[model samples]
Target: MAQPTYALIRFQEVGAAKVQTGLLVGDRVLALGEDINTLIRHWDTTEGQLDALAASVDGLTGLAVSDVEVLAPVEPVQVLQAGANYRKHVIDLAAAHRGPGEDEAEVRAKTAAMMDARAGEGTPYFFIGLPTAIASATDDLVLPAYSNSHDWELELAAVIGKEAFRVSPEEALEHVFGYTMVNDITTREYVFRKDMPEIGTDWYRAKNAPGFLPTGPLLLPAKFFGNPQDVQVTLKLNGKAMQDESTHDMIFGVAKLVSEASQIIPLRPGDLVLTGSPAGNGAHWGRLLKDGDVMEGTITGLGTQLIHCKDEEPTESGQQ
Candidate 1:
């Protein structure tokens, strides 16, 4: 039998600006709170009421899931993303981009060994993402005409419940309230600056474009999806499977990412710590995003996200 799945959402009537918090149960979404942001701030006290109602959805009062328009689940104060957190993903990139005479087998072996060492004592690499980059799961992505090398990185993000500062990995999971999905879009051309190599990655230009991070239609409570480390992470382009991997491939797990990130800065309610994307990104397949291309991303237990892409239209200034 399938486990009962429930989520929290923010939705509104189609084409209306009004939005409200909703409890997404079986086939319907119950009107649950005045504001989901404020509700999640006290998740420890709120989960009991939500879990009880989710245990049984019979005779629940609300609109059907299809009747209302789902919005980005939460208005996060901060969005944090980890880079190169997948073991195989790092090895694959290394092997694929090896220097002229380097053997593929040798490159893979070196990368694998480096990853093992990092797991033992290395710190995770995290960068701040703008909340402005977020979009609804079903929203259209405006493909910037500046570069045609747009790519997708489908990842699982942990939502912060309790405030955390200098927490250990062992105690990190307790602070996670739930999970959601984020598709971290990138522009390959701006990933590494050619003009100033010392500065390293230009994340703001490579990412942070409006609608670059298409987020959740659901926020699955952590208790409901125990062991997020073993879940499947898959994404398909158009109708073909482009990225199919599991969370087991991660070099650093969610808890470590959260803990390490907290050490850098305090984590608060509604803040998101994105566990990095696994292998099989667009770079692996040699096919980048384009106009009219559709991306479908899924994480086990969490719902699928469908995003559409279109080229950005030129304005009178002739800029995109």
Candidate 2:
């Protein structure tokens, strides 16, 4: 197998402001050699051109990776997230919230049966996230002071390369450009609506806080990242392992997610489809995020990300 091609956005200091969007290759970083937005606007055609430039050193003097700050590789136009897509995770939650006097084994059996039925007949559930909530891999996460149930959910994100509309699962993989990692942080208390019981889940406020979604230390091209279905997602909090599972546990895999998302809305290049997180969330461990906590997430072949957690400072208005 050939070496994987990885791309990143490096920041350079000039005067008082920092210049963003420098391309990174190995230890060296260089200018886009073309308009950054234009390159992504025509990603399918321009990626090859960018790759060619990265391969040559002629006339270009690049900077070292250690000297430059790194940022998120893509600024997505839209972010679509899958929910309740991991079998083990669903089963765990069901068992945790079992009815009074209910047997644990019985609950597991029933949950497994329901999951099987959904896999065979039901469609995958998806929700929208804001691009403004996205942060860089090494950025600090701000835990809202109002909610004490802040949680971590490490997920594998698929980067879209081509426009897709009502595409079939059989042909959906072709629309994928690459894979990256995202830590989908959430405030568990805001997930439900207490005032209106029938209003259903409120994912918007629960998952879209500023710096909630930290993405991409590197973007590994799809052709080089190998099988997305088999990648391992491992997360450690403060040097102790918390989430350790593989993408194989996903009830709905990448192709099914892409196909389902396209059926709802046309997916454009630079858009992201984040497959749901596996079991081992903070709720299960009974250990929510606290100030000064650190989270490290790693996906096989894709790089690792370190995020420092802190409380959101109180404003003069006293609102969180």
Candidate 3:
């Protein structure tokens, strides 16, 4: 049998104590022999075997997707996120932060030039997110009480399949097991530390809130995704389309991110590297997430994620 085009999912049956791995096909999902973690543990040898098994599985025996509660595909050991990788997104942010009386054209020109220089002489910027921040695609997003400018940034995430360290761009893609969608929710206000002017952006507080990184309806195998550089990423907020851009806008593509990341840190199996989001974020729209807002994000071939937004209730300790 040929390799199946599969979407690996983690789901729980009604009243189940633990999650199970499933092979998503059409409207149904078949039970896998083992959990996603087990597969990831042996990915180098098991990927092809799993694909072949999925291809031969009987669809009729599978459970309807609607019958199970879907969870984020994998609980990564590390979540490394790329920042300012989208050209237009960075340019828009730069223009928005320009000094008073600065010419728009000049800002754009300078930003573009800076991007080119970074691409040539500099390296990609990356940050860490705690695994505790991972949330299911269908989960509700709690807008942190501490932030007034909670925002949305939909992006594509690559799932590492093998241990990688100091790998070159030419061989980086081979280390990727699959791809998924990640909505990199941020608190625009917490991004900058007013208390410490000399200190830079505080991604830890801005991005690591519980349920901030809504990920995965499924994880599509890397080989089936073709070139990760050309996929489309779209996000709609409360039925209105907001972000619509191609991965082509990325200053650093998947291979570059993976290779560069390996040089800085060892990427273990099941680690995730989120390519930066494109333009059309809530910051650009001048509208932050509010109670009852619904964000739907999709990346070509990886599937879509619908996240509901709600305000976190304040406790006596004021901790959410």
Count of clashing residue pairs in every prediction: 0, 0, 0
Best model number under TM-score: 1
For model 3, name the residue pairs that clash: none
The global C-alpha lDDT for each of the candidates, from Candidate 1 onward, is 0.89, 0.86, 0.90
lDDT of 1 at 115: 99
Question: Could you tell me the lDDT of residue 6 within candidate 1?
Answer: 83
| Per-prediction TM-score | 0.96, 0.93, 0.95
Task: Summarize candidate 2's per-residue lDDT along 231-288 as a digit string, tens digits.
Answer: 9999999999999999999899999999999998999888899999999999999999
Report the CA-based lDDT of candidate 1 relative to the real structure: 0.89
In the range 173-271, model 3's lDDT, one tens digit per residue, is 989988999999998889989999699999998999999999998888888889898899999998898999999999998999999999988999889
Candidate 2: segments with Cα more than 4 A from true spot: 1-4, 10-19, 34-37, 57-61, 317-320
* Lowest summed lDDT window (length 10), candidate 2: 10-19
